[model samples]
Target: MRLYWVILCLVYSGSAVSDQKVYRWKDKNGNWVYSDVPKKGSEKVKLSTNMLTMPATDTSILTPNPATPTVTYQAKITAPSDQQTLRENSGSVYVNGLVTPRFANGFQVQLFLNGKATGPKQTTASFALRDVPRGEHKLQMKVFNDKGMLVAQSAVTTFFLHRASLLNR
Candidate 1:
């Protein structure tokens, strides 16, 4: 039978396992027959594969991420209108902002002034920026835990400072 030869070839041909080919043909009785032996009317047939395999996948990629509320991590500036001109009082500027859900215990607000970090970390969002040179400036806020891991942030705001010369006094 063709099935018999196919199995024999698989067991005997250890190296050419995938390359093995079998033959199939019908006898004078019209009965279906299978064999590896070549016959006058036999047709070539591929080896029967009884096994299947699937690639391993990462389950994390298929799972949905947990949702986090926006209010719990919001950082917003409430003072110093963007692009507004200011006449600094005694070279001091008050940077005021609001943080939602209140800061966690060990978390602090950091102010970025003119693209540079300024002042010491504070538990409050309000800060007193002193002696800022007259020029255009940008400000933004970042929240960090006691371990210095960034948690939340606010958009950058640009403001201009104009200080009159003391010669006019």
Candidate 2:
């Protein structure tokens, strides 16, 4: 009987020491946050309240699941033409009116210089090229949904800027 009691104590003690991991991070607003270690900056948090057990009743019944959000389409991209040609070291280049889908919520245009991504710009259906360096500049336009996911990618547009003529110099 004494041996049986000792065995039960050993089993209970073994189960009591289980550990769980969590992570911590700060948001753009500078608030501290915590999540599992797989999350960014999770190493700073000490584990707390690992073995809590709750009655298995439906707590979610009080709160309804949010309806799957629907995304509305907007203009796609590349109006007049998907491609353009320009001169090297030429001042600002213009990429005129790209088409947007009829039902689009908004448009995001990403510009690439040469082959590198410059950045993204938000507009209705048009984008202007500014301060393009001299040489072959490749411009690409991608359209996105209101949720900021790409819906369409326009054909790569190539433009060239010719060296200024001596006559002009």
Best by lDDT: 1
- Predictions in order: lDDT: 0.84, 0.60
Query: Please, what are the lDDT tens digits per residue for candidate 1 over residues 18-61?
Result: 66677889888998788767788899997766556788887986
Model 1 TM-score is 0.55
Stretches of candidate 1 exceeding 4 Å from the true structure:
1-72, 166-169
Candidate 1 global Cα RMSD: 15.3
TM-score of each model, in listed order:
0.55, 0.43
User: What lDDT, from 0 to 1, does candidate 2 have?
Assistant: 0.60
Residue 100 C-alpha lDDT in model 1: 78
Residue pairs with colliding backbones in model 1 are 1-34, 2-34, 2-35
Question: Can you tell me which runs of candidate 2 are displaced by over 4 Å?
Answer: 1-90, 165-169
Cα displacement (angstroms), candidate 1, residue 74, comes to: 1.2
The alpha-carbon deviation from the true structure for residue 94 of candidate 1, after best TM-score superposition, in angstroms, is: 0.3
